[model samples]
Structures are given as structure tokens and as C-alpha cells.
Target: MLYATASQTVGPYLHIGLADRYCDDLTGDAPGLRDSRIVIEGRVLDGQGAPVPDGMVEIWQANPNGRYRHPEDERTHLPLVDGFTGFGRVPTGPDGSFRFITVKPGAVPDVHGVPQAPHILVSVFMRGLLKHVATRMYFPDEAAANANDGVLRLVPPARRDTLVARRGDDGALRWDIVLQGEGETVFFDI
Candidate 1:
């Protein structure tokens, strides 16, 4: 009988591998950037409403055409955009703010061919967390699609707002993430 070993804790040194300038941009040198430009900006807050300065945020999503870049995603009808890798990473600044510039992802189908809402898959890594936290950021404007999303329905109605990002006057999405306490962002096990 083999027992699993204890998990190791993450530390404040995530910048070494995750925050290198090369891995920070997802919309680099592409016309797609001009056409589908949007900024996802937010801060990572801790239980006491303080910024988690050492945290790192990573996002993965389908391209604007709803197609993933991975070879396993063999949907031929979906249009592919040049220079969009459907992934990005950024580190929290001194104030725990993080921002991602990328096109809004299109609706991807579920296992049963149901069209899920357009949303970005977010993962957060930081010191003191044994494992990263997983969440999704849905667009507040995608009301109809969001109403039909299978994953969004799982969250209780009252707390669901935590997952939706609001668009600002400048067209940037403001979606702050709280690690604990009231109004904490909903994290999924998977």
C-alpha cells in the first residue's frame, strides 16, 4: 500500500519562473489585438482585505473563435486567429493588482454539445497555498449566454456575482478576487 506524500507549500518566489517578461503577454504582434482588444484588470485580496502582493495569476481560454490551440481540440469549423495562444500569465504588483490584455474568448461547447458561456479560466498561485486556486471569470455583458452556462448554475445565485467581471468605461474588465472572508470568489475543485 503506497500512501501519498505530503504536499509542499508555495512561496513568495513565484516571479522567477512565472513572471518573466516573455510569458506575460498573450496579445503580442497581432492584428487580432486591434480587433478584439480588452483588458482584464483586478487585484488579489486576502482575508483581511489586504493585497496578496506575491500572488501570480494565470489564465487559459479558447480564442475569439472558440477554438483552443491544443492539438486535441479538433474542431475544424472554428476560425483560428494568428498569434493568439489562448493563454497568459501575470504576477501581482505591489498592490496585488494583475492585468491581462487579450481578446474575449468565444463560447466553447460542453461535453454534451451545449454551448457554454464565454469566459476565461483563471488559476492563482501564491505563497502559503498548498495548491493553486481555480476559478472562472465570466463577462457581465454575456447575460443570456451566462444564464445557460452549466458551471455558472452550480454556484448559488447570491455568490455568483463574484465570478463575473464588470466592464469599466474604458472597456477594461474589473474583476477583483478575494481569497477569503465575505464575498470571496468561488473556487472550483477541478
Candidate 2:
């Protein structure tokens, strides 16, 4: 008789072969963007608020003109920055911290052509989960745009704040991910 294989969690060794691909600075090669550059920093926390130091975080976003570098983003009218890739991946440090340097993305349209709030698509991969969790990191200053965002409306008002990153005194955007328990960061089904 055939038997099913047991499920395995995401990682402890994710960095082994992926180290060469790690890119924390999306702005390193890109220059002369129309929008201002921004720093996004965050930590991955567990149920009891302890850090998950071995996780990986990845982000995808549009350029300042709201156009992705990928061919699938067929809005040819929107100019693409010469060196902007619109994608980044980095591993959590010993303190469960990760940082990315990039310009703030512009609003992209949904399938219906309605504009979405300026946000970065995020994916978290860590141990204790068979699949990665997906979420969005919205800009705190884009309150008006965020309020009208179709995707943001899908999340309850009370929990919506979890998706918005807070601007710290140092001016870097900070967002924390809670795997479970009280004050958990919202994860989308996708």
C-alpha cells in the first residue's frame, strides 16, 4: 500500500542556497526615481512575542509610477525605471529583524481597474508552517488612499491597522508580524 508523506515546516536552512539571491536594497541599482526613497524595517514575532530569527521575508511592489517590472504587468504606457526590479528577498537577522531600502510604491490598479493603496506585497516563510503566509504592508501616510482601497476594505476596520506600517521617530517604516495569539498580524488566505 502507498502511504502519504509527512508535512514539513518551511525552514531553518532557507539561507543555504538562497544567500546569493538575498537583496535587502531594492534601490541599490535603481536611481532617479520620481518618488522618495524609504526604509522599511520589521521583525517576525511568535505567539509569546519572541522573535523568529530564522525566517525569510520577501516583497513585491510596483515602481514609483505604479508599474511592475515583470512582463505580466502589461501597462506599457507606464515607464519602468531602468534598474528597478520591484522585488526583494532577505532573511531575518539574529534578532528576527529585516530591512529593505526602496522607494515608496505608487498605487496599482486591481483587476477591475480600481486603484489599490500604495502597498508592498509581503510573504513570510518560517518554521512551524507548511506554507508561507501572505500579507500587505500599507503606507501609514496614505490614509485617504488606504481608506478607499478595495483590498483594505476586505479586512475588518479594527484589524486593518495590522496591515499598515508605522512610521518611527527615525523615519523608517516599521511593521511587526505576529504568528499567533493576541494582536496577531493579519494574514490573507492567498
Candidate 3:
């Protein structure tokens, strides 16, 4: 038939084949769990400020030592953590909230060799989206470092707050994603 299949969006049934397991616990019993376990929690909201229950969120970051588990990372100076994969995927609950338990990531050098702020790469997949949205979550505590971050510096000052996660009362980080609205989170083109 030589016809291309139509593109389909990730609907409410994403959990079935994508991330059925409790994939959010990146530090569960892992060797690197004892030192710096931290929780990252947030909700995914739609344009009208309603929850997007069926969405899926995925995150990737370097270990505490700033070394990635991927083969493409060829930095010899960075130390890799044992038993830490630095990848997490979680399906949003009925309230559109997602959480992950992982160690605080270390700062990685930018393309110009300048140390960037500690951050996690996030991807959001949901119904009606032909492609997932990409963003970065920066730790709120790293204000100084974030100011010098190459990517953060490029973002308009007014919109930079959307990318920084706030520290909760219990010490966990909180960062919500607003897909569309007056305060929409800043998403990356990549």
C-alpha cells in the first residue's frame, strides 16, 4: 500500500506498555541510596489549571558525581555511582501528580566547559500531544549556579522561575508543570 501510518498521540492507556512498574523509585535499595536520597514531586496541569491525569513523566540526570550512565558521556573526570541508572519514569496519578525518589544530581559542565547548575531533564507525554514536551528542572538551592547556567541565562528572567523547583517544608523538591496558561512552564525545543 506504500502508505504511512497516521501518527497517534499517547492517550490514557500509556501505563499499560510504557511504564507499568514503579519506575519512579530510582534509589530504591540501590547502592547510592544511602547518601543523598531526595524526592521530586509535582502535578501536571492543563491550560485551565486542571489536572492531566493520564500523562506520563520521564526524567534523566547525572548521578551525584555528575557522571551519566549513558555511553555517549565520555567525561573521564566525573565519577559514576554504582547501581544508579539516573533514569526515572512515572505515570501521573488520578490527580495528575508524579513523584520520583532519587539522589540530588551534581552540576555538569556546559559546552563551554562552564559548570552548569544541577538539573534534571524531563519529558512529558500526554493525550492530544503528538510529541512529548521537553524541559529542565533546576534545583532552587542553586541560585548562584543557576544564574550562570548557559541554558538558564538564555531564558527570559520572568519565565525562569517555572524551571526552578522549590524546596518543600519536608525538604523534598516541588516543581509543577503547567502545559498552557499565564504561567506555563518553559519547555525546550529539543
Candidate 4:
């Protein structure tokens, strides 16, 4: 009898070896070109620190030129990744962890010429919740940019870090946000 090493079966993913094979999502490198880039992963846990197995998490970002991919956007030259959704959805695994690979979004302007701010849009849906929570994720380290950001100003200085994400490696970065718990992240009316 022969057994495979964990690395052989799971690559970098541990413990969940073999069981952690890829889903049918178009996340892997493609034949022609790969629009799939940058993975953001985190666990969604409850107040008691248990994983919420059933929920949906969505992330959206601007294009490389500080513009959105929406037709209504007036940006004349925002670069767009061919297949990247600018948005991606992920359902939690058994442990309540999910992951997504997408191209990093660019900053969008607030008043045409002025770049409004750089941010990522996050939407999460869970059972029993009356409505989905809409929120903005910002970068914590960018003090200068964040200070001038319209959205970041809404959050008090001491607690602003909760909304800002960290830059890691060459990927989209990582974060763990909460809807309603101790020290819940602020949600915007907009």
C-alpha cells in the first residue's frame, strides 16, 4: 500500500488534504489568458466563535485605472480585466472559511478629477438576517490616502483600522469582517 504526502495532495492547504480539491469555479490558470488573480480568504464565525457554514460573501473592486467596470461609470480610460467579474462569491466550507481569487481593483474618483478613494466593496448574506449588510473595506496602512478618503472619515480615528485591509504578498490581501458581534465593523448608510 502507498500513501501520498499532504503536500502532494493538498498543495499549500493542510489537514483538509484530498478533500480540498478545486471547485468548478474558473479560478485556476486558463489556456489563453488568466484574468483570475489575487485570492482573499478568511473565516466567518459567529459570536461564539463557531464557523457559520452557510453564508455568501461577495467582493467588488475598481479597475486598475481607479475606475469601475460599470457602464454607468464615466471614467474614460479605466482598464478592465477581460474575464474578471470585479466581483466574486464564495460559500463557507465546513470550518466557515472561504476564499476567492480576483484582480486587484483600482481607485475611483469622487468628483471626476479627484480620486474619491481606493476601496473594496463587500456584501455578505446569512440565514435569519433580515437584510444583507453592505460595507466598504479600506487599507489601514495608507494613512494619508485614508485620511482624505470620504468614507474613512466617517469612521472615528481610533476604530478605523477595522475597515482597512492589509497588503500582503502580491495578492488582493486578506481580512475577517463581522456583521454583528463584539466590536462589530461599521456599516455605511450608503
Candidate 5:
């Protein structure tokens, strides 16, 4: 999806659904078997800071092992995670927050085929925002490789931390999406 910041920032967002076909970011390869089951929940908001309650947030990611559903992948030797769909949707709450219950995603290698840190990639589509900004949600504090991700390397240093989730007291990762204002999700141009 594309957006023009100055004007007409509302009223149109290219229907990304048409690109329903997704392959692994690395090789444009599909999954050997279906294994990813991730849920993304967040609110859709307008420029005036109001919740767009009826908006939709679409999410897609690889299985825990980092395999996609694309047909060209050649790695079927790996075991598949069970009971996971690798995709899901959720609407925002009254205050403009949404929640999803999905399993943690596996890792996908970089352009060099070097295994990068694991993460859940999310897409936000709301009312008024012309495009569904796409960003990746990373596991908190995986220091060793967080510094190794090729994509993460592109974000300006100060903003990269917000891209990862922080661990909650319950040991689960928690991340919030702020549609507008300072600290909005760092969307990518990929």
C-alpha cells in the first residue's frame, strides 16, 4: 500500500487483499506445510485521534519454524506446528484497542539466508488512513540477533526499540499500536 502525506490521506487505500499471495521474504518461497497461527489485535484510529471501531487489521506470518504457505519452498523436511492457521483478524475495542491470540512465529532468514530473529509481522487498515501501514512485531530483548536483522538495521536507532514488544509480568510479550501522533508504529516500504 502507498500513502501521500500532505493531502488525500483519507478516502482511499489500495486494496492490498489483492496481494493475498505471500511468500517468505527471503526466497519468495511458499511453506512446505501450513504451520503458522498468529493473531494480531489493534485499534483503527482517524487523524483526529478518534477510534475507528469498525476498521479491520489483517495479519500474516510464517509458522513457528519460519516456513510460509507459498508453493515454491523446498524445505518440507522440517516438522510442522499443529493447530495453527498462521493468520487471523480482530476489531478494536471501545477505546480503540484490539487483541489477538496467536502462537509465536518462527524465524525467517535474511537475504543472505542467514537466520534472523523471529517476529510477527502485522498490517493495520483503518478508517481515513489511506494505507494499511505494515510493520513487524519482534520478541523482546533477543539481544544477540535483534542487532543482526537486516530490516531492523534500516530503522533509525532510537526508533527500533519500539518495534519490539516488552515482556509482561506473565512472561508474555505485550505491544501496543499507536495509529497517529508521536511513536506510531514504524512502517516499512517493502
Candidate 6:
């Protein structure tokens, strides 16, 4: 009998081995980056809007020139910055807050050659989940580009606001993720 193994939730101790790679800064003080640096800070909230203190958030994005650091990104026309890895991971604090410092990513082209909006791909891992949920953090300032993004178009108009991070008076981007219930964040099936 080939019974499948039971599913398990994501974590209670995600920070164990992951702490070594806990990078909150994608741009490691490297100069020559073509875009302005930005700070993104946010909280991971449960359905009731309480913080999920033991969660982790990971982000991947293209460089400021719209090129990824991965080998598969054959866009040689886009220059990669010297010290920017374009990837970051941060564990949530006791208040469920996480922060990242990086340059604003440029628009990357989709598979069909359509340009996506300047956005950071996010993955959330926490307790009570069989697997991580995927989402995106779009810049609120890039409204025109966001409007034309193929991926953003797939999200329902009424729910798209969940994906856009708002800039605060302090000049940092603020985005909160709600795991479930009312005003839940729009997570993708990927």
C-alpha cells in the first residue's frame, strides 16, 4: 500500500539554519546602483490582524536595471550592480515586523515579452501553513507601470490594492500581509 505521507505545517523554528542567511539588505553598501535606495517595512498579520511573531519573509527581485542575478536571466543589456544580490530574507520580530533595504527594482519582462511592473516577489512561511504562500509587493508610485503589468491584471481590480505597498510620511514603504479572513492579502497559487 502506497499511502502518501501526511502533510505538515511550515514551521515553529524557521530561523534555525535560516538565520545565517538572514539578509535584510540586498544592496550591500555597493555604489553605482542606478536607482534610489528604499526601505520596506511591514508586518505579517493573521486573520484577526494580530501579528505572526514567528514567521519569515523572503524576497527576490531584479536589479535596478531590470536584470536578475540568476544565470537564466540572459538580458545582458541590463547591467548587474557590483554588490547587489537582488535577494533578501528576514525573520519577523516579536511584533511580526520585517524590514529590508534595497534599491527599487526595475521592470522585468514576462515570458511573453510583456513588461511586469517594478515589484518584489515575496514568500511567506509561518506556522499553520502546509506550504509558503507567494505574493508580490508593488510600488505605489509606479501606478502607470502597475496598471499595465500582465500579472497585476490577473488580480481582481478590487483586490489589487493588497499587493501595492504604500509609502509612509517617513519615506519608507509599508505593506502588511493578512493571512486570512476579511481584507486578506492576495496570494498567488505559485
TM-scores of the models, in the given order?
Answer: 0.93, 0.96, 0.93, 0.72, 0.71, 0.96
| lDDT by residue for model 3 (32-122), tens | 4676789999999999999999999999999888889999889977888777899999988889999999988888888888888999999
Kindly report which residue stretches of model 5 are placed more than 4 angstroms away from their true locations once superposed. 1-52
Off by over 4 Å in 2: none
Expressed as tens digits, the lDDT of each residue in 1-190 for candidate 6 is 8999988887697678877889998877577753578999999999898999999999999988899999999999889888898899999989999999998988899999989999999999998899999999999999999999999999999999999999999999999999998879999998
The numbered model that scores best in TM-score is 2
| Cα RMSD, model 3 | 1.7
RMSD each, Å: 2.0, 1.3, 1.7, 12.3, 7.3, 1.4
Candidate 5 worst ten-residue window by lDDT: 21-30
Q: Tell me the lDDT of candidate 1.
A: 0.89
Error of 3 at 118 (Å): 0.5
Clashing pairs in 1: none
Query: What does the lDDT come to for candidate 4?
Result: 0.63
Which digits, one per residue and each the tens of the lDDT, describe model 5 over residues 1-190?
A: 9986675543433334634543223211324332332333444555566776655555676776777655654568754545444665554556767666565667777768888787877777665666667888887767777888888888899888768887666655567776667666688875
Clashes of each: 0, 0, 0, 4, 7, 0
* Residues 2-117 of candidate 2: C-alpha lDDT, one tens digit per residue: 99998888757767889899998888876685357889999999999999999999999999999999979999999998888989999998899999999998889999999999
The global C-alpha lDDT for each of the candidates, from Candidate 1 onward, is: 0.89, 0.91, 0.90, 0.63, 0.63, 0.92
Where is model 6 poorest over a 10-residue stretch in terms of lDDT?
27-36
**Lowest lDDT block of 10, candidate 4:** 7-16
Residues 1-190 of candidate 1: C-alpha lDDT, one tens digit per residue: 9999987778767678543553455788667577678889999999999999988899999988899988989998897778888888888889999998888888999999899999999999999998899999999999999988999999999999999999888889999999999889999998
Model 4 stretches with alpha carbons more than 4 Å out: 1-36, 111-113, 167-172
